[model samples]
Target chain A: MTFSLARPSTIVEALRLLADDTEGPTAPLAGGTDLLLDLDDGRSTARRLVSLDKLPWKTLAWDGPRLNVGATLPLARLGSDATVRARLPGLSEGVDAVGSLALRHRATLGGNLGRAAPASDLLPILLAVDATVRLVGTAGRRELPVARFLRGSRQVDLAKDELIESVSIPEARLSTYVWQRVRPANDVSQVGVAVARSGSSASWRLALGGVLPVPTRIPEAEVHLTEERPRPEDVELAANAAATHARFVTDKRASEAYRRRLVATLVRRAVARAQIPPGER
Target chain B: MTSEVALTVNGAAPRRLAVPDSERLLDTLRWRLGLKGTKEGCRTGDCGACTVLVDGETTLSCLTLTHEVQDRAVTTVEGIAEDPEGRRVLAAFAAEDALQCGYCTPGFVVSLTGIRKELGASAPDSAVIEALQGNLCRCTGYLAIVRAVARIGNGNP
Candidate 1:
């Protein structure tokens, strides 16, 4: 219930503050949507909360076909971007799937990645799009694929003094995300499926969210969906494989059997939705 | 754990106060600033009862730390009707009778006002609906709320 806030105006100062905060556990505060809740519920013991407000990370830029999303950019700014919608529909879809407009106004993609919640609406889509996390620390700067960065539920590969700088997404792809949830507004998804095909290579990437432990990419399923224009039966095989690929568990959000079923159904639906016409591709 | 802070509330001049770092914006508004219009429903972020505007954007005050919004402008339901869009939203809600228990009305009003400002006057109905997805009405069946949204989306606001 008690904590000290340190808002550093520069990256160096921020890093030093985080590194020097030997007071209990320390947490880097982004939007505070998830972290504050954790702190309130005794889920976090972070006595020193470092705010990233003054850092120049609230950027969203396009380089050729790639997109670089600044870590502090609000989800609302990202979701409402016409370029993001036109180029990366699945990413936009996932952004829209989070809590609400008000929450999204304060929720940042970096916060979502930093928290790494088991059912984060952004993870599956980030994996499907081959997004890489960019981090900076006293040690220096480095990048990691989102898959490698995720360790487990509420766990990430972030170091104590390191801060997420931005997320680098490869070329935009033909992609979409679908999910099943009790309430469309504020509830967590029971199962989320992301389907994507690279615009240049035409290869496929399949990822599932709301799974046990952590969300993961289904390479076995992606291999089945190799063709740019897959046959109907191939899509079916990929969907079935995706359902079989994950290790589902019966949790408070959904039953194991129900989640697997949802993975299959939503994957199939998302694949169809993400499919591009031969002329367009 | 506490520090002196300054902020603008409802178009007022910047005021300074010392507040605890653990205090949420909702707590600061209701308990410190004596602005109880922003009700606390879930205390969690799930409910929209603590909705307020931070620098013209809708934010969940219950989840927002008071220090997080230091030096920013916060507009609660109490000050919403002063804006032109807020005036229209309030009028539409009144015309549509968009209240039952009225506990959620302030949040709904503040949030809708924020959405309208963000989306502009000609935002589509779907956008309006989607923007309000976080708000909940435990009183009425939401038919009246839907009507109020329709009225606002149609140029009545």
Candidate 2:
């Protein structure tokens, strides 16, 4: 089954095309890394594809205190950008771990978040950094926290007529991301953890992925670490607390017990790594 | 909904053809243009047998749509045969005996070409490994392929 593809040069035109249901179901195509695979597999029945490749949103900019990442900015740029590496080190690490170099050159941040895969490397990092997603439609523009934007596995809080405009991350310090994968290279993580600390070291955020229905943060663990500088015992207690909150399932990749164990270990390692001097890592 | 899209393949004159929007660049290259050098492996993006250069950057033709290549230059393995860097990559592959079945060689060669273009000079072993991670080799255990890329990176060929 082949579909007609429409290349919209502007966001308003794209939104209009998406909103016209009388023309049949229309799906937006970005990067086409995952969307093409779905089309080839007969998973998508849309009759029209709205291509976002030529839109003006494929850029990265700094707006005041926050970094504005255009929804169409390729993952390769996100991983290699100097400012992103310095300010959002965890996000850099997470984007670098996605797919391979070739795929990275073509994949976009919007596609990664739009797919909303539970094992997506970018989701946990975005959650840890407290990123916000900017969405636009005929209804005008609104922003949603990254955590709230993701509704469930393979689902996002996106209306059919709305398109993601950009993702903004506020600057922070001492951020670190770590993951343990079955393969050493070019593989998705079996378990992933991200940690970001403020200047005081007392305030920190934590998020985990691949072990829950959605990439999420454990409030109990975050509160435990926010009280003071984390000691080895505190790290251990936080790790266990995070493990208790994670609800893992047995899949071909790993067993439920193994994922639970990995959640604890990765959280500990990520926290420790965040404390290391930038020059050392 | 078929439309005429113009593209430059292998440095040839821009060719215009009518194609369906769902037609992948891989199919257009192989079926329409008869450029069979770009093999189809794991039609999904996992296997990089369909690797090509779009505007000098490594790209997977299988995942790329026909319209995306409009007015863009695409260099396949066939087109790079006479290129100096492409020749060095191919020569290294031969000297290092980097194949058994040879089904995945074109993709590796194209990927190496992109890596050489990016690095511009000798590459560390770690860099070479990272660049070829997308191209998979079911034969030769990838040792000879990695050596071939390293040889090219070291300027030995």
Candidate 3:
């Protein structure tokens, strides 16, 4: 509650502020939805906050095959942007499922991935889409796969002076996302699944979240489903394989057994949804 | 440390004040500026009672630091009273008896106003529902609120 805030106008200045030792450890603030809560609840002991609001990282650009989403791009845009909705419907669906409309207006992609919460809606979809994250620091820029960027719950593979710049997702085909929660809507997912395909059924990518300590891709299940275009029986087998790969723990929102079951069900549904023709969907 | 930050509120002239770095915009509006219309039901971002507009975008004031809004335009419920669309939405809410306890009304009104601005004249029923997801009404069961928004969007009194 008692922290000094530094609003740096440029990325370099922001990185400098984060590296400064005189003010104690500084946490980067992007769309303060989660950071402010942590600051309010005494969960964060950061004595200083480096605001990324002024940085010129609010753009969403498509260069050839890669779509670059700035870390600070608000989640609201993800739902409403025509280009994003057209090309990355799975990511759009995941972003839309986050909190509420007002919260979406303020929540940013960086904050969503930076917090690395187990139930984050974006992480599973990003993993399924094979997104790459870009980070900048005094050491210059580095890119890492989304799965590797996340270290653990409430942790990221970011250094004290580093800031996430953007995430790049390659173009893919026949992708969709689905989730199941205890609440009807506007609640964190008990189990979420995203499936993306590049060409054939064998090229399918699958990721699951909320049933594990981290959002993760299930290559074992994906390989099983890719052997053939998923039939009802194939879906059931793939779902069971996904459930086997998932590690769930009982939380206040759901039981371990229930979440594991949800993992199977949502995975099946997500893949089936992904296989539907665009015209029908 | 406290610093002087200047920003426009409700289309007013820019106002400057020395605010603490940790001060949230919700506190600044309610306590410092005496704009009590922006309610603070939950200090966390879970509730939409503290919703406001920063640079014409719906934002949760409880999570927005006062300093972060420096030199930007902020719109609270009090500032939008004269806006034609805002007035129409409020009138529709009144006609539908959309509220009971009324603590969450200001937030709903502000959020709906933002939705109207974003969607313009053709706001769909589903978009309105999505927009209202952030707001929670403990008293009215939300049916009246949805009906009010639908009526306003449909050009019906």
* Residue A216 lDDT in candidate 2: 88
lDDT of 1 by residue, A1-281 (tens): 78989888999999998888567778899989898888888999899899998899999999988899999999999999988877888898899899999999889999999998878899999999889999999999999999999999888998988999999987555888898998778999999998787765456898888886888898989988888778889989998999887988788888999888888889778888887532243
How high a TM-score does candidate 1 get?
Answer: 0.97
- Evaluate every candidate with DockQ and list the scores: 0.85, 0.75, 0.79
* Candidate 3 collision pairs: none
How far in Å is the alpha carbon of A122 misplaced in model 3?
0.2
Error of 2 at A262 (Å): 0.9
List, in order, the clash count of every candidate structure: 0, 0, 0
Best by lDDT: 1
lDDT score at residue B16, model 2, on the 0-100 scale:
91
Off by over 4 Å in 3: A199-202, A277-280
TM-score of 2: 0.95
Comparing to the true complex, what docking class would candidate 3 get?
medium
List model 3's recovered fraction of native interface contacts, to 2 decimals. Answer: 0.80
Query: Which docking category, incorrect, acceptable, medium or high, applies to candidate 2?
Result: medium
Residue lDDT tens for model 3, A1-281: 78999999988899888999798768999998888888778889888998898999888889977789899988888778777666777887788789887888879998898988888889988988889999999999999999899887777899988999999987664778898877755688888899887542356789988856788888878876764367778788879999888888798989988988888888878887876753366
Task: Give the native contact fraction of candidate 2.
Answer: 0.71
* CA-based DockQ, model 3: 0.79
